[model samples]
Target chain A: MIHANDEPAVPMGLPLPNGKLAMWLFLVTEIMFFTALIGSYLIYRNGQPTASQPWPTPHDVHLAEWIGAVNTFVLICSSLTVVLALWSLHVGNSKRAVQYIGVTLALGCVFLVIKAYEYQQKFAHGILPGRVFEKLDSPHGYKYMRHVQEQLEHIEKHGGVNDKAKKACAELLADIRAGKLQPKDVNERVRGTKSIKETNPGKEFITTKDSTYVDLPERSRPKDAPMVEGILEMDTHAHLSYSIPFGNMWASCYFAMTGFHALHVFGGLVVFAIMLVMAWRGRFGPQNAQMVEVTGLYWHFVDIVWIFLFPLLYLV
Target chain B: MSEQHHDHSHGDHSHSHGDHSHGEHSHSHGGDAHGHADDAAAHFRSYIAIFIALCVFTAISFVFNELVRGGIISPMTSATVIMIVAIIKAGCVAYIFMHLKADWGKVYCIMIPVVIMCVMMIIVFLPDGVLGWR
Candidate 1:
């Protein structure tokens, strides 16, 4: 039977309807598109420098699992709505079709808004991608903790835990536990590129955040000596392929993948907006729903891509 | 209704549907409208059921993800289980919502290359695959 929305059967021997064939072809390309991206992610993640601690060590990145879960529900919910919209239209129920499409669009917007809020939180904390990634509380802070842990371990090995460095290590360890120092502290220490300097190990700040503090014994300075400052000195200009825990490879991969997916959601929203108006005008029903079906195909494909992305990035 | 007005505009065709015997009128409306309503309405319940299933799996996914983060399970094991659940969720969405279950047979032809490409991508990432070849 020739559907009102079905094209005159295609010239070729394609068994599928014209729109279905076209959508399937488009989906094929989309599959390959995501393959390139996801494949690159796997390669980069696997090819990281082999370390004793393993890749993506706990605390290396603090993804808000709750928000991610909420967004996942939103996407899945939107997929369900899209499905219902298609089915509703296929059953000669234009009113139900419009309602479902509207709900799907709303849920899609919710997903994007929550993602925006997540981005805002990360940005405030200086969690960004690539060269722009501000290591407010991530690899930078983790590195400091590891450094202090190493210093304490050294004292334990050499001086039987009674060493002076052990006391300093304990104080630093306290600072970490209390979450005393943050990206703000780092910025205050840096002040600007003018004040930012590469101070060596055991260096004290020129002006302490707390001046009345008892300086760690191992970090003592000579009287009348020129003032110095603190901040871990690491090469941020390292190549993406070489850096293990440093640099912003993880952030880069994350922004690239999630950003592209969000763009698709925006595109989907535009299509839904048009479809919502069309459905309101009573242009869609059981006899003429190929348009809605094709759009649903695209929406489902987007949902499928997110299924893999969520676990690979957040859960795994 | 717009449909009756449209039919009136084409007054030369006297039949109610104006469907030609040739069936080559490029998507002319067939004689029957809402003919498939019974079957579609019956299957509609399954759509809601699939939705409920999706929500349950979503909740399970989050709980399991939190457990993974909390170090209750090895990351590898957590990843495996999470991925399996994700695949199932995607399958339900595609097969039911996307109408893959009733889609024309040529869908297999479209899907085959996609699956092969995805598998090839995984193979290339394998430790002993072509990526490591000198």
Candidate 2:
């Protein structure tokens, strides 16, 4: 029962498919995209104020590590499921294959959900990738509070006659009018740059809406109203330059690469679902189990991408 | 080439001896079944080995990351360590877990494209790194 020469012969194992080739090619493009993003991040990171000042004392930034590790575990478990599913197909057990694929899809969903939760936490902490960073109330708040008291005393004593004194007074009045004056503004200008410690180890920042004051939640008062505490942290949130010239460029690329790769994982899930339906119908037998093999290759590639992304994003 | 075949079910199927020239090997029933089971188990074992290797590499990465983050090591040193470990981990996964060692030539077909892509990424990134320094 030989076929005609023109009839194409079906191969025994899936020897790579055009779609799989295309997916990998797309992933290659993604690698380049992320290289640019992460490279830019490193460059800007080197330029940071802390970058130059004896490697700013390391603070505990372990949240990224914890969340990223959990994500890695989820991906690894999903990979195991994918391998099991492929094995099921080879062993002529379509039912088990479908079961494993279902498990894999569930795990993928779990990963995405956890990622979303992490993003939410980042938002809540006001550590978003944007222009408006509300400086947190640090111990420097004490220094700012002192500066304000001294300025008030100077104004009371000499009637604020000196040119520098007058200018500081004017800036203070303007801040009072605008309700956005911060203590750092007065201290840096009055006491000079060297007097203030170069590094504020306790500096904290919160980011909420533009209208919200830096000390609003803590003070529970109108931003314009002068506090009686005499030690309130100044509101430098407006003057603070969150703009790292190349930060946006790096951020854009980071999101794009990770986003594109995530889309591929999503596409793989869709394909697996289709194959799952077919398997449920008993359409795939030992004679033709190429679908499972091809899908497994795609799933594995997605896993590999995350393996690379984890270190690049979180660890670095 | 003559179209030859072999009937492995000894004396069960009626076939001419001319079919034996095709090099289709046969095994005793118990031996063949045991060999297949062992092969499957070995495949699973390979999965375990790959997982363990991956965990070790990840731990190395984690330690290096701590050192760099804590300022005990420079960024360049950390990056270099990570790159070496990553390359080694990738090699193990690709060659063993993916069964590339069994067919090195075919594996190279996949690897060549990956290598080219990596090279292109470096080339494109070099200008950014260099110019950013200035």
Candidate 3:
């Protein structure tokens, strides 16, 4: 190996040293951290963008946006504090530099506090995507109620539940209970309705003209069943066709990306705090102020990441 | 170099000054050392400007984000718009606050690597999107 003085080593860039390089490397890792999140988001969103019912009804995502936006502002301000601190050190005021850095650190903490509040709200709303998935199917047996309401409204405007339809439905229920006419025994009975309740294996079969009238298990049946007479169609139909599973890829990505990024913001705050104390000690005057600048770079980077994350998570 | 090497106690009042010429150096005009108080005072104003800008940017982001998250606008579109604004805000902090604009050109070597790492991070996380990997 060549001797230290003899080696043909040259300064890199303008040549401060390895400090800037270290900062850069650290930033790279942070990028990876967010990438994992955004990537996951893309994957999950692709699979199920319109999973929520009513076809894009705005849910509680609005709540998250408020907190996220405020946090973003907090971070951006902190970023300025870092720069100002560095500026103070530049023209030569270690005391002011320290003060600015301290402010920046404090701001970081404020952002985190707001973030905690937002998370709490999410927990309260039972908004967990996974949990919501469990209730997605068939509107939880209230389809007929919705249907009857629509029909009732129609009759109010026109007259009433057509007498013919009521008579037909009542007769159908009576026939099944009486067993005087096998529901199946009447060929015309099993014509139009869609079956909601599953048929019990051991139960007796009541054949109605409408094939859709399969008797529900007693436990599953609603207490106040709307009079099942006529087909009460609503103007607005439930698009039960595309109820995608919740707790899928997007939810997972959203949590991971935002979670990891927030952790970095935390890390940045700690570093800034240490820098502040050092500055107070006059340890970061004009010459050694590089430390503050470096840390500030980190703080700014964190802010930038959040700017991207906020919109991606809340806006989308 | 000497300032970094020496461990001066809190009481060391004689401003340590040696070996500064060895590297691309910056002189620390401690509050007591500086003769030009006016210049020092001006730095404070710059700090305020940065602070104000930061606050305004954040406020705008908050309002915009609220509208978007409220489902007034779609999240995807809002994300893209916010990202552009965020990038601008970050640049201000980096160049002005962090003083990358004033430092040695060589400092960019450090910056470039950091950017590359960030890109790698995004690529690494991309698979999670496709596979449902957390």
Candidate 4:
């Protein structure tokens, strides 16, 4: 029979304490979860068609690498603080442990705040998955030509074409009237369209199609070009329609991986808050210092995930 | 055993057995207060060094990407180097920050199977997902 004062027998073949082993087991599940997510991302990324559906680069999506780098630094610093907190506890320094944990908590908040700002920017740009860009093969050229035709007609009605350019304008009108320049022909050459403001003082009031101007290159024609060309050139600001190929797929992966990771960070912040309270209450000392170390393990795992993610998402 | 229990319970009778047991275990390994302080100092310095190394790795990745963008280095080379650097950073975090180096317990026994499972998942999915076989 065991006496009241007898120490409890260690579990057979169990090398670690129960709490630590359980934490490691939990991390194993987490590792699998992230691995699956990242694996799927890689497959999708690698399988993308290079020519037809090229993946969008970081520039195409306006992802700021410096911000990501700063966040990485923040996380690394937080990881260091977490370890320091655990170290302080091991040395029986409860006040310093609480201070370190507090710093870690603040760093976590900074990371989330920065993440929230990035997400806001993405939303503002309409960069959500399935809506990253206009449909590939869209009839943007046809629409652009139709807008051109309308602008030409408006110039004719308003006598906007000067005498020096009337001849060229009439010739261009003949081409359109004779079906020489079909919508499909222009559509084939049209990549994308963007809105521009009319820069010429005289043409400022000349209403164009959709109340927007399309600026074509002035190098395409002479200085005293035709009315249509002149109207196209009047706008100094040219909006080009550029498509981000397979952008939806990229956005989906980016959001999923980073979103899940952010959630884990938030969870860690909550745990740190709790730990901070416990440390403040003087509950954490050499006796219960393992608690801080266990928590630090999870925090470090989060940092490791970000280390991989920083290069994959931001740098690459 | 009784004396050991008595020494642990002397100061922290309110703490649970789990807490005291862990404390006793670490203390057994710690030897004395002076030695424990020294170990903690070494750990502190190591953590600082690792943090600096991590920051440098992050900077290297950033600079490598910039070089690729500037056409000073090929994208392929930059990508390879950045990935290698990322893996090294993760390894450092796992090995040192996670305390796996100091405490090599059954955690690896738990980790090995999970690693194999992750690898198997990738292998199984690669064919259909990447090669478009199915």
**Which candidate achieves the best lDDT against the true structure?**
4
lDDT of 1 by residue, A1-316 (tens): 8776787744454555566678889988988988888888877776642322123422234466667778888988888888787766655466888888999999999999998986775564344665332233556545534444454355445644333334534554466557785533323222212222211111222332322121221122334545433221121211111112433666778888889999989999999999877667866455446667778889989988898888787766
- What is the Cα-based lDDT of residue B125 in candidate 1? 81
Superposing every Cα of model 2 onto the true structure, what RMSD results? 13.1
State the lDDT of candidate 4 residue by residue for A1-316, as single tens digits: 8786696765564456566667888999999999988888877876743322335567556588899999999999999999888777666676888889999999999999999998987775557796544332336445545554554465556655455344444555566667687443332222212221111112223333221111222212244644233322332121212245566788899999999999999999999989877667767566656777778888999999999888888876
Candidate 3, residue B45: lDDT: 61
Off by over 4 Å in 2: A1-63, A122-247, A284-288, B1-30, B69-72, B102-104
Candidate ordering by DockQ (highest first): 4, 1, 3, 2
**What is candidate 2's lDDT per residue for A1-316, written digit by digit as tens?**
7669877965532233344445445645655565565555554444332321211121111135657767777777777777777656544566787788899998888787877775565343323345222232455454445435554555545662544445555565556446464544433333332212212222222222332223222122344644231111232211212212233333444455566667877888788778767777877544334455456656766777677777766665
TM-score of each prediction: 0.65, 0.60, 0.57, 0.71
What number of backbone clashes does candidate 3 have, counting pairs of residues 3 or more apart or in separate chains?
Answer: 20
Q: What is the lDDT of residue A181 in candidate 4?
A: 70
lDDT of 3 by residue, A1-316 (tens): 7778997866434334356557766776666666656655665565333212111212312144466667776776677677777656656566887787788878888988887776665454333445322221234223422333343344444544455544444454455445464322222232221221111111122232221222222222244544221132111121111111243333455557767777888888888777666666756567655566567667777777776776566544
* DockQ of prediction 1: 0.26
**DockQ of every candidate structure:** 0.26, 0.12, 0.20, 0.33
Q: Tell me which of candidates 2 and 4 scores higher on TM-score.
A: 4
lDDT of 3 at B6: 22
> By DockQ, is 1 or 4 better?
4
Error of 4 at B66 (Å): 0.7
